[model samples]
Target: MIGKFLNRINELSMLRDNWNYEGAKPIHATVCRQAKALVVRLSENILKSLVVFPDVDGTLLFDVRSDNSHSTIFVCDNFFSYILKKKSGNNEVFSGCSWNKDSDVNAMISKIEDSLS
Candidate 1:
């Protein structure tokens, strides 16, 4: 699974500018590096629930879904934003956060993991 994740991320690097046919930016190198590092750190359970994709803006997205909830982490050059939706229809958003801040990222990951569990 980790191999699959790494392969998908690496494949993003092959995308050229305007790959979306709408003047979309190519995948940013920093975003891909950060995303690969993140994927390596994630637990197997979380990885199993994850979906990785790139946005037209050259950012990376990690989407995790469970039967009762969904969470998304949007990764930019040096930071990330998270959105979480619960079974009860509650939505929470956290934006303009740095990925270098381990505490913030860890807390978000833990919350998502716990909710999914």
Candidate 2:
């Protein structure tokens, strides 16, 4: 069943795209990490998506995770997650956000890269 949401439509589309990717068609338009962080450029916005499946309320909404057993925190309604994701510049783990072109962007980029390493 569909739980809570910040951006469900985008999430649904990404799931479809990833499913297609698993079938070997390989839609190179979007990118999704093994840890479930994803970024897809739609129109003029780079849409980032995080998994918060089947959750109604917690920290998992703000932090990146592969599990769906936690709460789905909608940041548009969550000032805390908004601040955290904004500061992190890597909201690719969440359902929605506006991009910031600043030093924080660089820092977040570095953080994600370091996670990869």
Candidate 3:
């Protein structure tokens, strides 16, 4: 599962780079929405597989910020339950979340990287 997530992430990153090389001004909203959904879906699955309690209730929200230089993916549950942020050229950061469990956060990060293989 983690492998799949990383593959998708890599694919998107490459796509974005290609678009930039082509001198594209901005990415389309639909594409962004789709990408955000995929991230949320994969995150949710990771959370579930870990048996993390208070499972997400299908209320994941994505806060995307991007400019000519960089992009960010912020995922959170409704009511700010949990927030995960991944920025261009940086590792994923767990800003805050309702879980607030260090072990869970560490495990999640590990899982995400595990998929990279």
Count of backbone clashes, every candidate in sequence: 0, 0, 3
What are the candidates' C-alpha RMSDs?
1.0, 13.8, 15.7
Candidates ranked by lDDT, best first?
1, 3, 2
Cα lDDT tens digits for candidate 1, 65-85 = 999889999989988899999
Residue-level error in angstroms, candidate 1, position 102: 0.9
Clashing pairs in 3: 2-115, 3-115, 81-98
Better of 1 and 2 by lDDT: 1
User: How well is each residue in 13-93 modelled by candidate 3, as lDDT tens digits?
Assistant: 334323545444333334344344444444443433321111122222333222311112233332122333343444445
Let me know the TM-score candidate 1 reaches against the reference structure.
0.94
Point out where model 3 deviates above 4 Å: 17-117
Candidate 2's error at 72, in angstroms? 12
Which pairs clash (backbone N, Cα, C closer than 3 Å) in model 2? none
Give one digit per residue, the lDDT tens place, for model 2 in 89-115.
444442333233334334443433333
